[model samples]
Target: MKKHIVNLWAFIHLVAHRFATDGVAQTAASLTYTTLLAIVPLITISLTIFSAFPAFQTVSTNLKIFLLENMLPESAGKVISVYMFQFSENAGKLTAIGTVILAITAFLLMQTIEHALNGIWHVRRARPWTQRLLIYWAVLTLGPVLIGGSLYVTSYFTSLTLGLGHEVHGATLYGLKFTPILLTVTAMSLLYLMVPNRYVMARHAWLGGLVAGVCFELMKTLFSNYVSHLPSYTMVYGAFAILPLFLLWIYLSWMVLLLGAVITAMLPQYAQGAMAGEQRVGYQFDLAVRTLVQLSHAHLRGEVLSLVQLVKLTHIHGEMLEQVLISLQDGHWVLRTNQGWALARHPDKILLRELFERLVFDAHHAQLDLGVIVRQPDLNLSDWVRSSAQLKLGEPCR
Candidate 1:
């Protein structure tokens, strides 16, 4: 019981640390701004696509009604709906260049979203621009079509269910009512799974998505109720209440989306540390050296070491391991390949002093080069590290 309590606290601390370090507020604010800029163009493009299909001619109208009834609060929805439809109609009159610009604006929003998600996963690199453009373009083009199709299918089945009420029970009708919640969960799960550059376990993504979906639904209900009951917004903004209300909702939605991502990113740590009571690994020069040595040996043996393999062998936190690996790559002491990490040079040629200098001393150059003189206590820490590594690894110090 005590162990479980300690582990739970540790998990909580880890999450709090990540949230602060990741700058969730700043990221959410950026996304909200970008989303606002992109929303009109996105809606215009989606409406154009919908109009291309005879079957989806009514989709834009239905989607507006759905958003007003389920997503937006009070009079805000009606206000925004009028402007959105108006802009979408005007979008159809745009020239080719204007249409291209609209698509680019929407693409920028998706790019920002991907960048934020990748940052959460500690991914320093991104997919090639061409690949990214293709992917984002497909999503922008196909996503609305899929959504419209789903809504149409749901509405049809709902009508069918109501018509057959005399033959069947009300269970199907009740289930159909929850379609919005189900779709929200499914979309959130896919976002969690697909946005990050790294692999996200399905179970972890789904769990986080479910939490986010439920919270979003509850927030919508509570916020809508608050908006309906409160006259503060209407009294202050009067004719322009919708602007603030819409912006507020977009900001809140981004916050919820980021919270879900944070949860998914940290789920592995929570599972390992909380459930297993894993001992925390403190930063040590020896630990970093040991990790590289293992990788070096694996490279010489014609083997590759995955991140999970390194974690198990080193018994270190996954985040810490990633940090060490990133440092190693930055220092040009290691190279990351499609398979795994390998040595940039032969293991024998790699000196303990060089590795230590690259991984530790070089990284601290900014601090060391500060105007203040080094005190006696800080004398030649690199030399000491080199000597220690030589003694521990039983190799030449060089």
Candidate 2:
């Protein structure tokens, strides 16, 4: 029980740190504006695609209703949905160049989402432009079809259940209550799983998605409760009141979404004893030791360990693992292949002292260890570390 609490607290601390460092709120605000700008173009594209498929026309209609009802504040949702439909219709009739421009705006929104997710995951490299374009384009084109299809399927079955006009009311009620939340969870999970150009455990992504979906549903309920009191906003801003209210809702939605992303990104890094080094010196060194030990074992088996595998073995997050890899890479102690990361040289060739010497810790950089002065006042940290181990970290890679 105590162990769980400590891990939970540590996880919370790391999340707060990542939230501040990653500028999650700022990123969400940025997304809100980008979303505002690109929403019409996105709608235009989705609507155009649906038009091309006669079978999906009804499903597409249902999709719009779902979005307005679930994602927006009730009073403002009605106004926004009406204006959005009009904007989408106008956008659909544009010339070829205008259509291309609309597509570009929609792509811009995709780019923004990718950037935010990649940052959360600490992914230094992005997928190639061709690959990214194809993937994002696929998502934009197929996403509505998938989502709308699910909604259609659910409603169709529910209608069948209701058509019986029998006593299956409880099951139908539960279904109606849970379907939107389930859909939200599924969609958010896909975003968390795919947006970042890195490996993510499915379980972690699902947990994050679950949280975001439930919170989003609750947010919608909260919005409805206070929507009746929007008379003041109406009195102050008149007809334009919907605009700010809409933006605020978008901002809050992003906040919830990004918090879920943070949770997903942070889970791999959180372990029962992972954060113990935070209060101790050489946290980086400890991470390095754990990583190198794993890589060394993999080397013995003539295997390359992927980032996902390393995280499991060492109980470290990819973000921290990347740092340790870089340090080892700098010293020619580790190698990264197209497949995964491995040891570049013999493990014993790596000296513990040299590894410690080369690595730096941020929080402990200024704190000198003077505990030795009480006994051997002449014994310095450098010599103590130097003579402690004979492992050849200082040796050249084979």
RMSD of each: 7.6, 6.4
By TM-score, the best candidate is 2
Candidate 2: segments with Cα more than 4 A from true spot: 2-6, 52-54, 277-283, 293-309, 312-315, 335-349, 360-398
Candidate 2 local lDDT, 1-398, one digit each (tens): 99788778878888889989999999999999999989999888888877778777777678788888876778889889999989999987899999999899999999999999999898977888998998799779878777777777777887787788865568777887788788889888988997788778899999999989989988888877777854678888988888888999999999999989998988876643555665577788888999999899989999999887987898777777787898889888898897889988898788776676667422233233323333354787787566544535544322
What lDDT score belongs to each candidate, Candidate 1 first?
0.75, 0.82
lDDT of 1 by residue, 252-321 (tens): 8887878788888888767755234333332445657878878877987988887767877776645557
| Model 1 residue 337 lDDT score | 87
lDDT of 2 at 109: 96
Give me the displacement of residue 138 in model 1, in angstroms: 3.5
Pairs of residues clashing in candidate 1: none
List TM-scores for all candidates, in order.
0.76, 0.82
Residue 276's lDDT in candidate 2: 65
